[model samples]
Each structure stands twice: as structure tokens, then as C-alpha cells.
Target: MWRTPLEQTATAALFLGIIMSQIVGEGSAVKVLSQPGQQVTLLCSYNYEDNTHIPQLSVQWRGPNNQLLCHYIKHKAYQNCTRGYTISYSPSSITLTIQHVHMEDFGAHVCSVSKPHEFSDYSMELARMSEYVTSAPKSGGDQSGSTWTLIIFHTLLSVCM
Candidate 1:
């Protein structure tokens, strides 16, 4: 009967350009499906006419609640990355690695990058399979198949958006 904070944040992110197609090489929305405590990576990549400007770029990763998870500035990740997450950036891409994903980590993730002339940002949704299974209607009706089908459809649709 109630929506999770993750759902609310995802909706807000969509309205705030997080769902928009970015100028990145990869697809705009990256969806990562994982178990409860598996490693997951959210990839944020971009390309520019010039590679020399890569060093001047700044990248940031935010959680589903819009909390700052980590940031890359001056070619180094901020202190937040030292805690449990690892962020690495190359000239063309930035990757945020969640060493051990938890339920709290299952939701929308945002990656924002800014350069001199190009700025790109988008959101990625990370979902857990258990939630999908356990959160279904408990009326003894068969819905797992449909639930997975819907999830896939929406994931593909969001990426294309």
C-alpha cells in the first residue's frame, strides 16, 4: 500500500533529467540486476571531440536518496569512495563499484559528469530479485512470470528513453 523511497526518488530523478538521454557513448539508463550482497557496477561514460580535457572533468555518483556516494575530482575519488565504494574514471568513462550491495543499495543511482563544454548525467536503477519475488501479491496467484516480464519491459523502455 506504500511506495518505497527508492520509487519516489526514481520518479523525481526522471523529472529532473535523470531519465533523459545523455551525450554518453553508452545508453542513457543503465540497469543493474543483482542479488542481495553481490558486487555491482554503474557505468557512466562520455565522449568528446578532445581527449585532453578529460583531466579537467568532474564526476559524481549519487544514491537513490540523492545522497552523494562518491565524487571524482582532480583524477581522484573523494573521501566517500574510501569507505565502501570504489570509483574509477578514465578519459571516456567513470565506473562506480559497490563492493557489497545491500537492500539499501537497490534503487536508482545517478551519475553526473561535467566538463568544460560538455556535461552529461543520467540515472541507473539497481534492483534485487528477491524484492521482486517477495513483494508480489500474496493471494496465491501466479504473478512471478508477469512481474519479471514487466520488469524487463520497463528496463528496456527506460533505456530507450
Candidate 2:
């Protein structure tokens, strides 16, 4: 059976659409690092030729274990922040702020964005803390507390040494 010219053109256009989506779906990548107990922020950005055509930007954050830590949908944040996290976004940028970093928060993190019919993403790999911060000695600390303090002090000193 012979296909009409209009039908043939439509089929070709559809095929091209799929190929373009795959090409543009893969976004960029970035890496970030911070010390434990400190705050950190991850950023994401997107550009469009037609500003008005810009699609809604969806942001997702995944932890080292591929766990879903947080997400932004329709300008709202749904976060499972273990120690308090926040999401901020605009037409061109999306920012994820994580507070009170811990050892468990180390390692790879993924950020994804979904827009209209296209998608983009990036990844951030957190490095191990090189040192730890010491807090003021507690009033009337027990003997065990002092011992733990000494141990931690030596550890930090050794690293510096």
C-alpha cells in the first residue's frame, strides 16, 4: 500500500522528535564538597531560546545510596531532610540547600530537572571531611567525656601533623 505525502511527512517528523529528545535530555554535571556538620548547597540551571516557552523546572535530589532526599514540584518543596534542607528555584536556576552535613551524607548525589518534553540533570560527589570541628567543653563534664575529647583532639592533631 502507498502512503500519502502528508502521512509520510508526519511519520518523519515524529521520528525526529524522539531523536532530539534523547540528545537534549542528557544535561551537565557538577561536583561539590563540604565538611561534616556544615551547610552545603547544590545548583541547577537551564536555558531556553524562547523565554516564554520555558517549561516548569522540576528538581530532584538523590543521596549516595540512591535515596530520594528531596524534590521540588510546582514551586513547592517536598523534602525528607534528615537535618533540615531547603529548595529554591527560579526560571533559570534551582538551588538545594542542605544543613548539618554528616558522614552518611557523603558520596555521590544526583540532581535532575524535568521541563516540558525535555529533561536535564547533574551530579555532585561529596568528599570525606578532612577534619572535624571541636565544640566548647561542657560544664561539669564526666571523666568519659574528657577521654573522648582527648581522643578526638589527637586525631585532629595527627591529621594536621
Question: Per-candidate RMSD vs. true structure?
Answer: 10.3, 22.5
**lDDT per model, in order?**
0.64, 0.57
lDDT per residue as tens, model 2, 1-161:
21543333323332332333344443533334456666666655555323664534567878889887777775344444444777776766666667767788878777777767867666666654334345555787555764674454445434433
* TM-score of candidate 1 relative to the true fold: 0.60
Judged by whole-model lDDT over C-alpha atoms, candidate 2 comes out at: 0.57
Q: For residues 1-161, what per-residue lDDT tens digits would candidate 1 score against the true structure?
A: 21653443334333323223353234456555666556666767567524455556688899988888888885454435736799976677678888877788878988887767777776788866433322346577677775765554456436644
Number of colliding residue pairs in model 1: 0
Each prediction's TM-score versus the true structure: 0.60, 0.55
- Name the candidate that leads on TM-score: 1
Regions of model 2 farther than 4 Å from truth: 1-28, 48-50, 53-55, 75-83, 132-161
